[model samples]
Target: MNAHDRHPMTVPSEKRTAISSLWLWLGGALLVLGIFFRVYNLDYKVFWIDEANTVLRSLGYVSQDVTDTLLTGELFQAEDLQAFQQPSPDRGWDDTMTALRSSAEHTPLYFLLSRLWVQTVGSSIATWRMPAVFFSLLLLPAVFWWGWELFGSKLSAGLATVLVALSPLHVLYAQEARPYSLLALMTALSSATLLWTLRSPTWNRWLLYGFTIVVGLYSQLLFTLVAIAHALYILASELTIYKRFTPNLLRYLIVSLGCIVAFSPWLVLLVNNLAEVQRKTASLGDDRYSIGGLIDRWFRVLNQMLIDRELAGWNFLLLLLAIAALVYLWRQAPRHATWMLLLVGGVPFLALALPDLVLGGERSLRVRYLFPTVLALQLTLGYWFAATIPTKRIPQSIVQTILILFIGLQILSNTVNAQRLVWWNKSRPASTYFEPVSALVNTLPNPLILTESKVSDLLALSYWLRPDITLQAIPDVVTLEIPQGYDPIYLHNGTPETEATLQQQGIRLTPIYPVNDSVDPWLWQLEFPL
Candidate 1:
């Protein structure tokens, strides 16, 4: 009579058990759905330029190799491009390492693992993306561990697992042959380990944390921001709690230094190749967006973390929810946990975002660069929901209903994205046009593709084109020949200079695929001199 009556908010033990079971089942189901989406249309999407490069490096070839072999104004069969995509006896692991080193901005770990992955499994497009799928699947558990450690609540961990599992952006990257998913996995694991180490500064735990740091850096350079966040959290926590440097803090610094020493080889490589790295990554710093545009895109990306339908007003609502969650955490949670969350969530974002805002760059606009921020935000939201839903003030049913609606929206977004051959996340212009253009080209009786565009573009398209088609690289469009016997010839990704040269030669190009001036056409049909 007394215990239950006095605590009206305290649900009966059996009711709590039932609610917990329900959440566990829902989390399990969402996890299965996430896995299904990651592997569903693995080969359906356009293997865009970046993915093509991933495959190339995995096969122990670089962009320079493609240029040297295929882009010397030579005529090659569409099938020939597959050579660079396929692993060979001649291009061994050493060659793969060499190829990866050429692209100094790209860390070698993912590519090296990809080389091994393809060697074991055949180099099909789906197979190439499987590593990312594996990492993303692992990410669910990693995120779960992180949330559990941060909030010390099973419900919070379960909610975090469910949220990340259904994240459309994560699902999209999981299907790509890229390291972003690996980076997420590393970030989550490292974060969880950091929290675990803080709870008990055991030697083994510290060693484990150091390992995550090294692997995290290898996973992606952006992880440097994560490590910095960890260091800041350690320093701040020690100062606040002990009011002096503690042995635990000293251990963390030593472990971090060890990780830095372990990572020095790559550091040396990056430093030595600074100019090449800068040149390779110069596009990231392009003055592409105004401050307002960047802020709008940031909201859009945050919204995409869970729901990507782009419904009007959704972004602003999400921003408010995120703010409320952080405020709630700061007020309700322990100071150390709140501070850790803030540092983990805020540091990486400010590091990237400030550069873009003040110096003018698009670094923050790239969703992959902001993955740590996304994961931290998801965790924050999870903790807030877990803490709030069980309270007597807000009816549990109402909170559950809101969460269900959010999940429903994510499911809807995933359904729409799964059916698409290209999406906004595939930022390259050619990715949007490749599928339709390839379809049009395949329909012709005999087709020839001529381009003066980069060899990388041709390689990207080769994945979509039929082996029967012929591709001719016209280094100088003035030397282009209207090869006989091909009923129709298409110009692919023709440069402005190429178009001007063709115009001077009196060749008329009719826009074919896009059929609109809204975007510069990628495919054009040429009317040769009679």
Candidate 2:
């Protein structure tokens, strides 16, 4: 018999090669699916409050309807406001940067890119979401490489790519014209480099890491947590290896100093606007971050990862899996399982939770804040399924089954999120941004639309609606004078509060009546005797 036939090495080698090819093919297929989902229904959801901010900020157009704060006269030029009869033209680059620096949160990286993007693509709703879609698609391959570097398993890397591609929350952010996708991509890149750097701290890698941190901070302030997480991981690892201070220990210290020097501009800006940051945080979510609150939020994020729903009882299962994965990594690959595990999976979450718990901030409750850590957790799970259990000599089919279950859950979660966005009335998942008033705008003659919202909100709507009808948010109706030959209509935002507030202010109306109007942007319309 021939040597090849006697040993049967050729057939087994062929089988292994075939399996590897299949894994690669599967990964490619999943990447395509993820890109399709990103592009699908790009202009589906209406510009909610947050999305409206993105549009206005991108346009650099100050709305005539600036929110009337009680202290506006003291702190801002409410009277000197720049109101545009038409959607304001693009403010020059410098002005755009200046406006964003003062008015909107975060540094101007994403918004600046978005402005230039809209200038080229045209600022239609569908076109606006394209940048985020690109970022989301970009993340698939990025995550694959990052996971590969950490776990050293082609299967784990491919699976991590698949998981990120199908992640419902990531998909939702990907469809929006927001900075989270950009931030996610940056952090993922930083994470991949950080993992490589941990293995061997070289000068080129340190410079790249510092550069990424600068870009990430420019993208979003939350990225600082990622930097801190890396620092802690390096410290812990060095302590374990050397157990005392040495020249090698100074390597990370130098990286920190480099970041400090590079990020000085944003650091100064951050300090100057601390109060504004606090206000924005308070506006974002509940500010309680106690031990109990942290536990609740941890589970909430895990829930978002696993089920993408708000229902309870799934937290325990998630916690158990996390423990099992950690224990397995600790036992099987202590070198990799120590620093990478803590940096990627532990520190970012704790960074947010600890600060919020002590300082009582608003970010702890938000899922987006923990994005870096969330990805780490996902990566760890991928390693667990691909390496840990299989390393223990478990049946390959069981491991494959676990992988299938995870993918299935992710797909189902995407389906659930899709249905919610498509059908939810509050979200108004429609093509045109002005769908809320589409029927009313063309039908009503010379209609003066009144809202209790800020001028910015009305300006955003005006951006979508034609400049034929007038939109205003007058807080005080008593001083309001009705223009001659115009029908006055008040769109109620889910309550008779507008009418009640009018009565409370002793503003006698010319038969201010509420009609169940389905065509108007608001459900309740108060027709007044003007």
Candidate 3:
């Protein structure tokens, strides 16, 4: 009967429409920006030491392999490593797998995917790194989906997507020939999948949850830790009477069984190589970490994620402010606090911390291990931005604008450096760093390199400086001989033992041209007294 009753909420509804449209465009722009960032100079790096492993052992995509043979080193026959120590495209699939299991110590999913990809496209540096870029893109929508689930607001989810897109740490891994980006992506999906199972323990959801865990494990060994995080969430949810425990509990057990069955093949191999695996992983965390060291490591990784470099000057100040805001968020949104912490932060923290306290290696120093933790932080910040009631005094528009501006600043920090836009920090891409080496080689008239085959990645060397140089291996450093007529003799990451033996053999080498981040220092001409 009243005029006010006819379309009473029209104005407010229009305002909501406008805000939603603005955020949708803004988030879409950010996603586009991320894609552009990843594609910028995508092929700017040759395979470096770690990447060489991916090419040679993981995928067999390269023309040759530069990895070394296994320690029981003398099995140089049919099952001897085809790509081991010296990678030639001539090696077979079995040989590559044999070398991977015996030495590389990685799962075959990424590598197998890589194998199929390169077969179709023809392997090149760009082709090799394309998978990382693909996964990096997949993670974008995944970030938005998870963020939306956490905050139930497009603004929050969009903000988180922009941050994940512009993350320097993630960007670095995205441009490499490695599985870290996949690990980060899988971690998010697996976590979400498990949460979905708990929320609705249907047959389909349980199957998906189990399947995601299997893929996550195949992606990265560290992903198994996420299982612990899921269990913790389930226990906490049950303790708080959030979910009942009958069929869901049984489904959870079945899910666990499914994951174990799926991962059984890799488990068998892992058990066989348990000693080698232990020896290799033992170097990750050390028992000697002081409280100061732990804090420093945590802070440094945060800086790396946002800045694409270390914290300093105004950037450091911004990071501090961000930390304050995140702390505020933790207080305001405790709904998922326990789950987020246990899933993304606490389990990882304890896993690394316990190893450092009990084991003797420095495992937690590597920032890559904390990718999931950073994801959780980003989600928390997203939720804090989306809240309708907690900070009602502050206008939502201003809050959204401020958070968006802060994320923009982070993007600027990473993109300001042309190199960091593609990888990490001011450190040049592998291609850029090796450019000088190639330029140097071009100037040299017929170069011969004498290197210890195992230590030097000749595949990388050949990749950059090919055809003009001949690489010779020195089986015994004691019989060191730089043959006459090789003109300039370069030692590739020569060992102390080799240098001493050369001196004992009365061979003097001039350290004429030395390269940074190279397999070895070159010995050209001869050493001259200052």
Best by TM-score: 1
C-alpha lDDT of residue 213 in model 3: 84
TM-score of each: 0.95, 0.81, 0.83
Q: Which stretches of candidate 1 lie over 4 Å from their true place?
A: 1-15
Tell me the tens digit of each residue's lDDT in model 3 across 1-530.
Answer: 10011111122566667767776897678778778878777776455656656777644343223323332222122122223323346766776577567643577778767766776787677888899989988998888776655544566667678788877677777878888889889877877666555555789988898888889888888787777787667666665553556666677788888889998988899998899887866656434667676656656666775555554544555566556557656555445543554467667756876666565445565667777777877776665555531245567777767676667766775476435322432133433435555567557777666655443245554556645455566666654444557556666556778777676666676664453346445433333123
Worst 10 residues of 1 by lDDT: 1-10
How many steric overlaps are in each model, in order? 0, 4, 14
After superposition, candidate 2 runs with Cα above 4 Å error: 1-18, 62-90, 198-201, 244-248, 284-298, 309-315, 355-362, 388-398, 419-443, 463-467, 492-498, 504-523, 527-530
Residue lDDT tens for model 1, 45-119: 878888889988878888878878877776788888878888889998888888888887888889888888889
- What lDDT score goes with residue 179 in model 3? 85
Candidate 3: segments with Cα more than 4 A from true spot: 1-15, 59-92, 242-244, 285-289, 313-326, 357-360, 388-405, 416-433, 453-456, 513-530
What lDDT does model 2 reach?
A: 0.63
- As a TM-score, model 2 comes out at 0.81
